[model samples]
Target: MAGSEGPLRLRDWLVAQIESGRYAGLSWEDADKTSFRVPWKHAAKLGYQAQQDAALFRAWAVYKGKHLEGTDKENPSVWKTRLRCALNKSADFCEVRERSQLDISNPYKVYRIISEGTQGPGTILPLEGQPGLVSKDEDKQSPSRLAQEGSLLPATLGPSPLADHGYQAPGPTHSWSSTLSEDFSNPDFWLHVRLFYGTALVHEATVRTAEGCCLSPRAIPANAAAEYLLGPQPRMARVHFPEPPPGAGALRHLLPHLERGVLLWVAPEGLFAKRRCRCRVYWRGPLAPHRARPNKLERERTCQLLDTRRFLAELCAHLRAGRPEPEYQIRLCFGEEYPGPPDQPEERLVMAYVEPIFARNLLLHSKRLGSETGP
Candidate 1:
């Protein structure tokens, strides 16, 4: 270990060196700086020793351990698996690959740590399915070149049609006046409509009823609708509910049931419009079942809200934004109120939900947002 430093500091510096590829083929400008700044908080939650924990600081920024910490005490194997996933995501493991084909660029390069020319596992990313440690012969194959041998791939819906002349699913086609009832004054009714119509009607109705603003607008693209609904808060999921005829089958079951956090899911097709609407709901977070369905043959469960006020606050923020009567989308927020430092009351976990068209695209694009495009 380096002189005058504890084991933790030494390990952290080692991780930075590995990340910069000083021991590999390449070296980065500020890799060492980030090592201390990155994974300190995460290592604390993981219960890593001071020395081993510093290694984490050299790699990741924050840790996600609220739920997993308890589970780790009861189950060792599961904990290691979870830890492995978090640690494996460091830049040292990432490789340049063909964006379109997702194939690794180099086959001969393999990354490992060396001390007096001996191998170690401070920051290692072995090929998929193989042990985190691989033999020198196996180094010929780049970790990035390995195929996803045993991962669950998403359901392929064929190449994207949106790139063509606007892939559109027909929305409900009826005179605007025909759908609104004489006494449909309730805010909840509008909330349901927003989920199905993708905010085209929600904003229009709000302006006409509450603020009386006359705004001519076009359909709000699905993606913008969701982000707009989320307002400034970072939302991770969206939820959908069923329309009346179904008597709240799956929709009824899913509410904010988690001890903390939110839940979102796809809205049922029946609830949205007389004719099928292309819009989909993006439910945020995972919650337990509100109430089990009566006819649940397989006995599936659902979720419910833990704090209605927080949910309403986030929802209102979206509604009150400049576009009172937005044409493209409608959104709702959910929240939970937790006690903070003494004498201070603050709302936590403000989540939002919107139509799926917006939600799905946001998720797919988020991971690749700033990444440079590949030919």
Candidate 2:
């Protein structure tokens, strides 16, 4: 055992960093997903230090337990997912949830002390499912609240696309049922449109499958969020919703189904189905993605946000046989420094042109979405 000092070392480092205001300069990510990004400069220190105190990583996990010094019998709703926006090699990535901001009262200190060493990690139960959606506040909100506060869908259509919350088959005599498994091994994609009301993430849908945003996915590992953001998700899921009839089944109506953060399957057109998963971050009109890259010397530079306006425009013209509407390619960019994955550049991207059915289906519902509501 590394004694109490093993975990205490980490606690000390975090305490010192807090004292020196390391967290004061945090990097932003897709809506509602805030990581306590380890600065690139500090990567070396954490790396060498981690080897010294192997238990350090245990203290860095997303653990849930009662406060070490609280009188209440129930655990306070405190969460800590250790991650930071860091280079893959550093292994220093960590997440700081909107609500999990640490104060001195945090129980991590007590848990770390009792746990002993890396191998002897105590019972600080780690979070199992999607770490993105684990915030206490989000737990309280039902699907209805999310729609009213976050979605662009009409009030009537939302809350639940299925009227009964759990709907039966079309006929009175028939009932269709399928069990949903906790094992989300089935691959899919989520199409996310995060609207930032000024700096606050008003509407957040992380890619739970591919159509949502952060505070968003299970497919994405909590530690590798930066890499996922900077690159395209590799999967064979082809997402397509049924085209609705003329008026009622317009983009707005289908969105309740399309962008609901779940995957829809269709029979393949041929031997294979098209698999394209692109994640684009849109800022209000005339605005670009926030630039938050750090120098190589000062920070590890784990990811980058790059824009894809020029390419999408040319492609739009060639495909549609005419120039796209003025509001089509509003000022938007890929949230990371690079667009698409390595050896492939054109695939994972889109322009927010609201024609529906095509041109980034159901992406930007309305042109004025960019500046519809004032900051």
CA RMSD of each candidate after superposition: 23.4, 19.7
Candidate that would win on TM-score: 2
lDDT of each: 0.25, 0.25
In angstroms, give how far residue 285 of model 1 lies from its true place.
24
What lDDT would candidate 1 get against the real structure? Answer: 0.25
For model 2, the superposed segments whose C-alpha errors exceed 4 Å read 1-57, 64-82, 85-143, 146-282, 285-350, 353-375
Cα lDDT tens digits for candidate 1, 200-292? 332111111110111111223455532232111122222232222345443323332211222222211100111011122122221112122
Candidate 1, residue 6: CA error in Å? 33
* Per-model TM values vs. the true structure: 0.18, 0.24
Q: After aligning candidate 1 to the native by TM-score, how far in Å is the CA of 100 from where it should be?
A: 36
Q: Mind giving the per-residue lDDT tens digits that candidate 2 earns over 1-375?
A: 235633232333444544454242332332432233332222223233332222223323322112332443321111112222111212122223233333422212111111122121011122233121221111133322332343223433334322322211121221212222223321222222332222222232212232122222224454553434322222212222223335633333323322312212111000001111233232222112322321111111111111112222333343345445423222222232323345654322221211101113212322223245428
